[model samples]
Target: MRAPIKTTLLFSMLSLCMSCSNTTALNKGKEKLKARFEVAGICSNYTFSLIEGMADTSLVAASWTNPQSDSTYTNAFGVKNPCDLPEGLKVGDEFYFEIDSNRPNRCMVCMAYYPTPAKKLNIKVLEIVKE
Candidate 1:
C-alpha cells in the first residue's frame, strides 16, 4: 500500500511538469508571431453606425477606451502606415487606410471612426489602376 501511494505521487508530479513545459513552449511561439507581425494601429473608422456596412462586407468594428487617459476613441482598426499618425490617432485611435506604395498621393482605402462621437463611418477603396 505504501509503495503504490508513492508511485502515484511521482507520476502526478511528472505529469504536471510536462504540462508546464508545453505551456511555456506555446507561449514562446505566440510571442514570436507577435514580434514578426506589426500591429499597424487600432481601426478607428468603423463606428456603431457604420457597423452595418462593415457587416454587409464581413468586417469587424470595435470601440476602445484608453485606460491611461480615460478618453475614448471609437471604432479603431489596423493599418500599414508607419508614420506619425494624425491627431485623432495620437489620442489612441487607429486609422485604417489603403495606400499605393508606388503613388504616394493616392490612398486606395480610407476608414475613420471615433467611439464617443457616435457618428457614421465609411470605408472606401479605389479600384486598382493598371499600369
Candidate 2:
C-alpha cells in the first residue's frame, strides 16, 4: 500500500513538471520580444507612420516614438487577430511608449490588451470631429 501511494505521488509531480515545461516552450518566442517602456507621454500624429507590404499593401509595421526618448523601434506589428490595433489614433492624444528589445531602433505605443475602467491601463480616445 505504501509503495503504491509513493508511485502515485511521483507521477503527479512528473505531470506538473511536464506542464510547466510546455508552458515555457509556448512563451519562448514572446519572451524574446519583451521590452521596457520607461518614458510615457503624448506625441504628434506626424510621428506615427504605417508601413505596408509590397505584396498585400496591408499594414506591415507601425513606427512611432516620443521625441524626448529619441529612440525608435521598428518591429513588425502584425495586423492579425489578437495583435490588431484600434483605428482612429490621432495626434494630441496620450500614449505610453515602449522599446521592443527585438527592434531596439524603433519605438512603439504601448496599449493594454483590453479596454478597462478597472485597475488596468487606460486606452486613450483620439477624439474625432463630425464632418
Candidate 3:
C-alpha cells in the first residue's frame, strides 16, 4: 500500500512539472507591452497596476489610483518596471513587459471587498528601459 501511494505521488508531481514546463514553452512570442509601475495592490491579487493603455484594459476592474491614472494614490509614474518586478525595482520604473498568465499563480492580497483591477494581469519583466 505504501509503495503504491509513493508511486502515485511521484507520478502526480512529475505530471505537474511537465505541465508547468509546457505552459512556459507555450507563452513565447506573446505581445510585449510598455508600462510603468503605478503602485502595489492592497493584496496579492491586485499586486500592482501599470500606466499603459495596453495592459490597463481593466474595464470592470478598479482603475489605477496614481496621478498618471487615477491621481488618488501616493505612487507616481517614472521608471520602467513590469510585473514580477525585480528585487531592487521600485514603483515608477518603466519597462517593456510580456503578460504571463501562467505566472504569479493566483493568491490572495487584500480584502476581497476592497477595490482592485478586475483584470489583474501577471507580468514577466522582459527588460527594464529605465534611463
Off by over 4 Å in 1: 32-131
TM-score of 3: 0.46
For residues 15-84, could you state the per-residue lDDT of candidate 3 as single tens digits?
Answer: 9999999877775535676666545544432224444544333321334453334555222222222324
Off by over 4 Å in 3: 1-29, 41-63, 66-83, 104-115
lDDT of 3: 0.52
Candidate 3 residue 12 C-alpha distance from true site, Å: 32
Q: How well does each candidate superpose onto the true structure, as a TM-score?
A: 0.27, 0.30, 0.46
Superposed on all Cα atoms, the candidates' RMSDs to the truth, in angstroms, are 14.8, 14.9, 9.9
Candidate 1: C-alpha lDDT: 0.34
Give the alpha carbon lDDT tens digit for every residue of 4-55 in model 1. Answer: 9999999999999999998886554232110011122244322221211222
Model 2 lDDT on a 0 to 1 scale: 0.33
lDDT of 1 at 110: 41
lDDT of 2 by residue, 70-127 (tens): 5553422221121222354333333332212233223354553421111111112222
